[model samples]
Target: MKRFAIGDIHGGLKALKQVLERAKVTTQDQLIFLGDYVDGWSDSAAVISFLIELSKTHNCIFIRGNHDDLVHHWLKTDEQNENWLKHGGQSSKDAYAKLTLSEVEEHKKFFSNLENYYIDPENNLFVHAGFANMHGPQNEYEPYMVYWDRTLWETALALDENLKPEDLLYPKRFKLFHEIFIGHTPVTRINQTKPVNAANIWNVDTGAAFKGPLTMLNIDTKEIIQSEPVHQLYPNESGRN
Candidate 1:
């Protein structure tokens, strides 16, 4: 069976479809979505709908991103704060334009309850953001903070060698995994530029929602398949402008 690792989607249904089609994913294949399912683009509704449908037909696992948390907070609390709304939440608003309050609540509950992260039997892990260097697999709450915190990323990349991967036991060490599949940073290289211990982590958030590339990594084979940024493919798009 083929295992596919997908990057932060950020509501780019087109890019997601393009990559999946290009990869020729079949029922025999498995998929891991790194999140950022909403915000940035005007197609959040379409993308979420696609995800729900795809979940039925494929071996799919979805992890919650920071943006997903914000959207859920708004729906559950009836407060779309400036922080979340400004960070590309307008697109999600547009997507939820006609949704009744009940519908919003339903959607909100869905995202809010999404799993924080996933660890395969292989000990390979998948998360929207990388793990916290200081707290990994410690308290169950650790995954929540790690997946939503940006500061953790910098800290992990700068941890003291003694307290880092080699010195830790099991998955608590961010670098204990043979490979960590992540998406948060938007970059040209999927595996990120840095090398951490024996593990190689990738930042697959190819920035699709920002008119950047959409990337996918075949976990078992480590093959990268990418699709052109949809926005850049069409220079004359009016709404996308």
Candidate 2:
């Protein structure tokens, strides 16, 4: 069975469906989603509902994103954060408004159960964003940093291309895992629209929330599959653009 790492979806269910179909994913395949499943696009609630069902049929590992956390907070307390709404939460709020109370509660439970990070038997670490601790995410002082931190990716990017893992200057945290896969900061920020590898970190977030496509990467083979650019699929919407 193949293991695939999916990038942030950002409510682009059409893009999500297209990539999965194009990749021909099977129930036997292990799908590790890197989060930000909701927000940006128009199908926030639908995306969550779809993922909840997908998990039942597939070996799926869901990681919590900062946006997902914010939505959960709003769902539980009915207090919407203004900042969250400004980003992509407004779309989520609008989409969720169509759901019944029971449905909302079910979605809230799904959000509550999401993991902050996942480690495979082969020592590959999957997280929504980066972790700060040299000892890895398990030892992170601020738990939320796992969903919000950019330092780990930045540190990896800043490292010299020729720097070997055994070099004294190599960051200690990179040594803890065979490889790290993350989503949050888009690779589009660097003007690339595909998964990028820096040191041992693989960034799969290809800006599906903006102009790029939804991406899925085979962790073992390093093969990539993507949907059409999100904006083209949802021509009427501006998804976090």
Candidate 3:
């Protein structure tokens, strides 16, 4: 069975559906989603509903995202974070407003149950963002770093490419996993609209929340499937712009 690392969907259910169909995903395939499944487009609640149902029939691993955490808090306490509201939270609120109390509770459970990070049998690490500890995510003193840190990606990107794993200058974190897959930071920041590899860390977030398309990468083969730019799919709305 194939294992795929999917990028941040950011409420782009249309884009999500497009990539999955383009990839021709089968029930046997393992789908490791890197999170940020809500808070950008008009289908935040719908996306969660779809994912909840999809997990029942497919091999799916859902990693937690900072946005997911914020939404869950709002659902549980009715408190809205101003920063979150400024950044795509308003859209999420708008979408979730349509759900019944029971449906909302179901979504809260889904959000609460998301994994902070996932380590596969093959030693591949899947996280929504990055971790800070040198010993790896499992040893992080700050658990939230696994889903909110950008230093891991920054460190990976800043490392000298010529340095081999066996070299003394190599990072201990990189040696802890066969490969690391992350989302959080969109590759669009670097002007690339695709999954990017820095050392052994693969950034799968292609900025579907903004102008880029949603992406899915085949972990073993390094093949990719992407949807159209999300804004095109939702022309009437600005997606976290």
Candidate 4:
């Protein structure tokens, strides 16, 4: 069975479908989604529904993202924050506006049950975002470090190109995993629109929340499948603006 890691989708259901189709995902494969499944565009609810259905037939692992947390908090506590609304949360709210009570409950369950991080038997780590501290994973790091930490990716990016892996002072967290896969921080932030490898960490968020395409990486073979430019798929959008 092959393992595939998908980056942040950000309500681009069309992009998500295209990537999955291009990858030719099968029941025998393990699909790991790095989260941010909602927000940005107008189909957040549709994205969640598709994921829920996909989970029924595939070995799917859903990691919690900051946006997912924001939606979950709003659903459960009826709380709203201006910052969250400004940062694509309004789109999510609008998406869910028409759902039935049962559908809303199902969506809530899906979000609440999402994994903060996942470590496979191969010692590959999958998280929506990186961890803050260099120490190992902790239960107390949720809703923050699990979905917002940039230190892990930053450290990998900061490594000297000339230094071999063995010659560097890699953090304990990095040492714990054979490889790490993350989203949240889009690769486009560095002017790239493809999956980036820094040390053993792979940042697959190709900015589908903004203007790049959705990216899917084969964890075992390093093969990549991507959709068309997200903006092209949603020309009328003001995604995450």
Candidate 5:
């Protein structure tokens, strides 16, 4: 069976559907979603519903994103930080307004049960974001680290251009995984519209929360599939600025 790693969806349900169809994902395939399934677009609730249905038929692994954490907190306490609202959390709140109480509960359960990170048998690590102060894959790290750490990617990018993979001294987290996949920080931040590979880390967050497209990478073959630009999918509104 093939393994596919999808980047942050950010409520772009249309883009998500397109990428999955383009990849021709089957029941036997393992689908790993890096995180940020909600917020940004107008269909956060719908996206969660789709994921719930998808999980019933496919081997799906969902990693909790910072946005997901924020939503969970809001669901439990009805409190949201200003930054969360500014960065598309308002849209998520609006999306959930349409769901029934039971549906909302189901969505809550789905988000609450999300994994912070996942490690495959091949030692590939999948997380919403990189870890900080990591000793190994098994070592416990802060939850925020899984959703906010950018130092790992930054260090890899700062390496000398002439340094070869074999000659590199990887950080503890990198050494623990054959390859690491992450999605919290969009690759667009570096002015790229596609997945960016730095050292052994592959970042697939193609900025679907704004102007870029959704991306899905076939982990085993390194085949990349992307949807049409996300803005086009939701012409009626500006998706989270």
Candidate 6:
């Protein structure tokens, strides 16, 4: 089966659909989202709903990004703070504002079910930010560590469950894996046209919210398929504002 790891959606539902269509991802393919499903665009609620459905049909692994973390907090606390509002959580809240109590609960359930990180059988891992190794010799951390730090990555991978560096970042016992996939740091952004690509890590956030493109990688082939942004039409003004 072909597995795919996608970058942050950030409320870009249209882009997500277009990319999925272009990739021809069926029920057969395994889809892993790298987090930040809400924030940049205008469809946070829509995107979440789509993801819940997708998860049922395909092997979907949803890793929580920093932005998603905020959303979860907002849902539980019901406090509409600035941090939550500016980072796509507000869009999600607005989307659900009109729903019935039952419907709202359903949405809460979906958000509650999301995972923080995932480790594939191949020893490959997917995370939002990155992991921090806490106790082991390697002090192996989680995926959240990756989103924010690169230097400590070596140290985190140094330890395992027992808190000891197994002598291998990824234990040789698990077999060799090619790469670790992540998102959060954009490769390119609307503000900065120049991209910061991660050579060792695959940064898939192609800056869709900045109107770049929705990118997905075919893990087996390392091929990136993307959907160009759908431009919004504006009214032509002969003299009107």
| Index of the highest-lDDT prediction | 2
All candidates: TM-score: 0.81, 0.99, 0.98, 0.96, 0.95, 0.76
The candidate that achieves the highest TM-score relative to the unseen native structure: 2
Comparing 3 with 4 on TM-score, the higher-scoring candidate is: 3
Q: Model 2 over residues 58-162: C-alpha lDDT tens digits?
A: 999999999999999999898978989989999999999899989999999999999999999999999999998888999988889999999999998899988
lDDT of 1 at 57: 93
On lDDT, the stronger of 1 and 4 is 4
lDDT of 6: 0.64
Q: What overall lDDT goes with each candidate model?
A: 0.70, 0.95, 0.94, 0.90, 0.89, 0.64
lDDT of 3 by residue, 110-148 (tens): 998999999988899999998888888889898888989
lDDT of 4 by residue, 1-241 (tens): 9899999999999999999999998999999999999989998999999999999999999999999998999999889999999999999999999899999999999998999999999888899898876565564445478898888888889877776656656456678789999999998999999999998899999999998999999999999999999888989988985
Q: What is the TM-score (0 to 1) of candidate 1?
A: 0.81
Query: Which lDDT tens digits does candidate 1 get at residues 1-241?
Result: 9998888777777878998999999988899988888877667767777887788799988888888887777666768788777677877877888677676666766686677778899988787876655445444455567467654345545555455454644235555566677777666333432212223565667666665767888888778888777566434432222
Question: Positional deviation of 112 in candidate 1, in angstroms?
Answer: 3.5
Please give the clash total of every predicted structure, in order. 0, 0, 0, 0, 0, 23
Output the TM-score of candidate 6. 0.76
Superposed model 3: Cα runs more than 4 Å off = none
The TM-score-based order of candidates, best leading, equals: 2, 3, 4, 5, 1, 6
At residue 64, candidate 4 shows an lDDT of: 94
> Candidate 4 versus the native: TM-score?
0.96
Model 5, 66-182: lDDT tens digits are 888898889878997898999999999999889899998998899889998999999899998888766753464556777877888887778766765566454555676889999
Answer with 4 or 5, whichever has the higher lDDT: 4
Give me the overall lDDT of model 1.
Answer: 0.70
